[model samples]
Target: MTAADDSTFLNISLPTGTPKAERVAFLRLCTALATASLDPADAIDRNLWFAEAGLGDLYNKPTLAAAANTLIDLVEQGWTLSTAYKHGPLLAPPPSNADPVVEKARVRRQEHLRRDPQLRKASVRRFVEGMEKPREFKGKLVTVFNLMRDGRELADSLTTAPDPGSVIRPYIQIVDGSRCERTGYLLHDIWRYFRHTWSNAYSTVPGRSMPILIRDAATPHHAVIGLAAISSPVVQIAERDEWIGWGTDTFLEEVRKAPSDEIAAWLAGRIDAQLGEIYLEDLLADNVLQPTDLHHPTNEAIAMLRADAERHRQKHHRTPLSEVRQIEQDPWVQRATSHLFRSKRAAMLADTLEASRTLRPFFSPKPAADGLCQALSDTKAKVQLRRLIRRARGERVGTVIADLTVCGAVAPYNALAAGKLVGALAVSPKVIAAYRAKYSRPSDIASSMAGRPIERESRLSFISTTSLYGSGSSQYNRLRWPAAVMGGPNDKWISFTELGRSRSFGTSHFTDETVDALVRLSRVKGAVVRVNSVFGEGVSPRLRKVRLGLAALGWPSSELLKHGRERIVYGIKLVENLRDYSLGIDPAPEYLLDPEQADETSVGVWWFERWGQRRAVQPAVLESMRRHRLVRPISHGARVPLPTDETDTTPTESMFFSADSS
Candidate 1:
């Protein structure tokens, strides 16, 4: 093939939103056309091509027409054998009189292609092979793989030995959901394993979810350690709200009162119209003059009426109604009435009267008849009103805290104290900075402060239960940062009681039973298993199959896989920030580089000297630490030992480890 044909075939770019069947058909057709010796001038016969590819029965006329048009467009763009072979590939055709900039770009691309012939050739070969043998679709059904039985040899090889001399360093990196590269595959596999072996509950990766992979960077082959998924900050948390001075009662009260307050303000204005009508009615009722007489009253009669009204007003405490009556009796007033007050008074009188009647029940400060205050107070009316309020406010109702949703290490790494490494990275300034930037919009910041949907700023990070509590493993507490450094009162290194009080208020697809099953599975297996979704319920079978395939070898199957759902609501506060908190940090000072460098020994010594001398640590800090059994009293300048005995022997491990450990 000509260089142009090679380039065109090698870099096939398909339009998005095309159906799978049509895409496959198009690929097959392209491969057939490229391999066959056809004349460039001959128009492609759609019917013959479809028949040759065994797709004649599958596509309809409209679909075939669309496909034909797409093919024609591609050929026009030099993405076909005719254009590639007849003329050079459009990407780098023989120089025509073109713009200097465009020509320079083309020449540069050609140079790169020439310099990397092997890479280009490999790419072309892969594309041709892929087009020639497209993947066949089987009807969606998940067949459990017996990894233990079928892949015993492979399984044994993977688990047979641990490299004692080879240190396992896990690096955590965030995956961009928009790109479907190797990182995407890593995320998919992690979720799959969690579903089949850890949690039978199906989990979904949310649009705002930051999916992270933990990989062993020490080995030549970067094997995955585990998966950590962090979703958008929660809108409401009871404990978090309490901490921020907005508890459940306060949040609900504010929501309920806002609408009522609005209605009250409207009613207050409305009451004034009723009062005006009442004043007008009293004047009209007490008038002594007949309507005809008032319309054509002489000046003498007007003077007499005025005199009488003055006398009545002097005798009574209130103003006499005859004062207004006398004005209506004047000839000039009658004439002006015809010009200005003829229909205006009548309309005003009617409106005020109607308002007075409608507001009669509320005059005594009772519940408003049809206003928001009335609806909020009445239990029956509150449901709809509450929904309206929530919708109007966009469901933000509490304080926001950056939640550390999932944190742990896989088998080998977990055994090697990799949990602390992953945990520290989870709260690293870089990761936190990315999250903050993601939600930096004005709307997001507003929502987060209000405890609503958008979460832009977070001063705290928390976890629900320690790995020790759920998985019978001490990796979380031992390896992770002590609660003191995270900005909590020393007395409460970790709040065990708060775990039960944390609440998740949102809709989730998984039924309570499914969630319970997943939790139970995690407890039984001694692993932290989280459910994103279920199986056949609302989830697509194709997606379920792909996720299931990512399970670890020797995964056991269960029958409770009927429901397919993504997104679960679990509430707990496992991590927190007590002091000045920020997300990304410039590379930490060279000495404090690695995540492990922030270990208890280095941190404790630093705190004792740096913060202690300045009295930055609270008076109760040391006491609280001692109370929590987090530290042992020692003389100044004494060395702090590692948390575990296994770690104590590895003095070199502590010194050399850095964030650049990867």
Candidate 2:
């Protein structure tokens, strides 16, 4: 329909009036009588055909006029076309009221059946399988695997000797049977057993057997697996050493005390134990005995002694090397020796650091008589000095600088450019002495620091820090809303730093860059309004409102949103920031990084299309939009851009360089 005079008319609500009984009857009669005398079988088509055939000749036909009069009478008597000209008292009295009650019960029963556990399980499976891309199922599979790993550990503990009728078989079956969609065959059996064990298994039962056990536990089946998979978390907290150690400490002690002949036998029996349990056994044995065989002991006592003796004999029989030059001749042996030395050093370092906290306060020495007088003025400085000294020795200088800047211990400029600040800090006498001693020598400070010659610059495409949004992340953007697009400048066109400290740009210079990116992204142009939080300490609630509002606007499916690779990456970053901020560890916000814009996807574009259609751009506006390829008419209305095929192989750069897209 043509729009009314006002632009507001384009937004009219759909009419909802229902026709009266008399009017409905009259229309039905006219339609039926016109169709070959209302033959019910050929009603619609024949009526139109007959109407065309007889309308011209109706003036000359008296009989036709009488038939028409009869039709008019039927209509006047309130006979619909389906009533066949009879207005008789209905043969069947107003449908038995019981029928409706019966129908309602039937409908309820059908609904119950549809949601029946076995049926719903099947449905859930089908639903998951039908998903073109299945991330939830993938996550669930990981959960299942983790559960299986834990179950395997527990299963090993359950059995001492192999049995044909082992519960391990059923246990493994149960684990494997747990599906991403529903509890599988064996798991369902286990679930049934669990339900029988617990009276409150299903919500339907109180003092009786739960009638809807399957239905009640049906939805939470995968959830149960999920809980089990991560169940190790609390267990780890409860028994950290036992949880992390491959074998039990007692089991390892037993292995260590065992005769060399028995070590292999013990290991053979204990390989199936938890990793922590086995690891302890090996470690204890290494501590007490010589480093005989680095690999595992043999499976049999007799075999183990022979292997041990042979290794020992061979070691004693080999020629010894005294010089470093001799050691370099055997590269494999040198590498192994180096690895051993490095590992031992690392362990020593870890132990030293753990103990250093206690030792860091003071060395066991009295200072000179003048020190006592000077120390009184420097107690607080001494404590700060001790911390700085320990940090200089134990932590990376760059990390210390960054933390100091973030915590406002030092200015950002002073931290990044560290010459004068380093001289002023007065951290460790040892660290300072080493630096001063080196720089005081007749050697270049830069050469000493690098200790190597520089190579030619690499020719590879070097992605700069500015070009990327996140560390070790992808470089794609997914904002597709017109408002989101227009809110920021396009990639090459806009520099967000020019906007100054816009709330949208956030506090950091990096945030301004992020704002620029969002502005440049093609989607930020059509936001109806920006809502700020009226309450709360942060903008989180307002951000949530935007999310839910867009969702109501028919946000695309999870799959569609997932398909926007760049958008998903940004969304992940946004969520990560939310988490980091909660933990007081916010990364400097980068350019074009509006949390809402960052989280927007191609799916969100679909939502804008849905909301935009209701408040349509007029013909003149639509035509203008067409020039920019923003909108296009389909059968009834304009259609949105659908996702493109991944394998199209059309060069992305080519498409990007093309004219303004709709």
Candidate 3:
């Protein structure tokens, strides 16, 4: 950490116009910081705090450079920022009123106030006071609201309790959002409310979702013992992608040596003839396209695109992105896009197209292992067969591969580690069947673009989720079922595979108000806010808007977006070959669970034997369950108390500050 020994990290070049005195002072400060043990986010915050107090000048390029150098050094030494930090100073303003981050926060507050003025708040308060009389919960003898039976009748079960594993029958029921039956959407929303309320990080995004209710038949009225849901998987996840081998894997390896006519016809059929031209027009005109938009274009295609995009930027001298319908109708662009694919990759792509045909364009900081070798490595041959494979990976991201939005047991069941049981059922046959039924309908976006309902076979092949708190989820650790029982290969197992942690990059930490203010500020700064709230515009529009705003404020969006905490990611495969089945290369998925014999019932039996019985035998589990008697405070394990005198929702200031937020 000393200057003599740590010169590599401490070596920094100040700005051209930086005074000699300031450079010397900054280097001295940098030397002190280099030895200090601090996280990247903490260092940035402390530096900014000092700068605001006239102790440092972090605004200037020279000071920022020094700080960055120090940060890079700390990062190399195994220091990191928590990605879950919400009020990070990196993206937001410092405490100083003059700071841009502070100003943006002020603007966000102002905008929120302006949108819903104090007058409106006062009016609503007055109206509420005048309209309704204050009421309290009274002993309800006539109007009873509960899913459980009479307390007296239930209380006896604890004293003369039967073996929970033998009597308690657990089963999974698919919750359809549209159904009006008793065991339908209402229960799902109720479960979601409890789920989000208890877990600070749990959230549901736009797009596809499937809510499943786990019920215990032994309990009165088939009461909800646990809840789980499946939602659309994100298009890009670095750790998940690398594990799936999106780049090293090949999509058309067998067809590589096929006849030119045969290959051409197959490629032509795979191409979206209707949406291809229109999408390509949007791709060239606008910013760098989302890789999911293209169908794994070849090395030649990507090169042509970068060249064309650069040309458009220079010629237009303004906005390049166009999602408008007008461009789709452009005759010349239409003609150009029609031949763009065939002339570039489709024509030249064959067995002969080897490592020599390298991609000149840069996708990331480090080049991928896309057919590169040392034998002919003298040239700058950067082949990008990754895109084609990546495209295959993305095909099922929206449909076939669903992420668990919420998966865990409720109170009494959780006492016996029933959460593990829920995790086990996540990959059961019933879930797969339910997913197929829910998403088999025509895609609205695809249907509209093609002028007809496009019915594609959308079935669940994989189920994935991230740990809620830390580096891994305890409920899923060593959780597996014998593949032979589930009708899979005997050598393999149907278990959750560790897919590495996420890179901890997102805009979740930024409050809605912060994002709104940033978007407003971006507009004032003459920055084109591309997130138009339009469907199919992009994933996580709020995040996109926030990134643009951060950039407008002269900050690196990529760096600031990384708040630092990364959660462990896990994936469960229902099909034999997840990559191939997901890419539509395999016509029918080789599901792990048998169609006729193996089902949710089998899963229930396994859960009882696998985890439930073993847990119930533990003295701690029995003692915990004993406390959940009829008269005991409800939902204690979930950190929830009902609308009663015991319910303490009001915080006493100690929660927010060292003393009080006073």
Q: Best by TM-score, which number? A: 3
lDDT tens per residue, model 3, 413-512: 7765678778877667767777777789866444433334566667777778887544346788888888765666677778888888774667644544
The best-first sequence of candidates by lDDT reads 3, 1, 2
Task: List the candidate numbers ranked by TM-score, top first.
Answer: 3, 1, 2
TM-scores for all candidates: the values are 0.30, 0.15, 0.61
Q: lDDT per residue, candidate 1, 1-662, as tens digits?
A: 23433542323323344466765665666566556655433434445776776555532433333334334323322233432433211222232323545433332332222222222244433432232221222432111110001112212222343632233344555655442132223344433342222221234543245556655444433445555655644544545444432343443465455544434444444435223321222235446333442224444444444544444433322323343334333443342232122223333333333333443344346433346455456564454333323322222221124455566544333333444555555654445445545545533222212222333333224323322121123434333333455343454433223322321211122223222333333333333222323210122323332223212111221211211111122233333332111111111211112222222233333222322223222333223222211011211110111122332222232221111111
Worst 10 residues of 3 by lDDT: 653-662
Whole-model lDDT values for every prediction: 0.35, 0.23, 0.50
Error of 3 at 600 (Å): 1.7
Q: For candidate 2, what is the TM-score?
A: 0.15
Best by lDDT: 3
Provide the clash count, candidate 3.
12
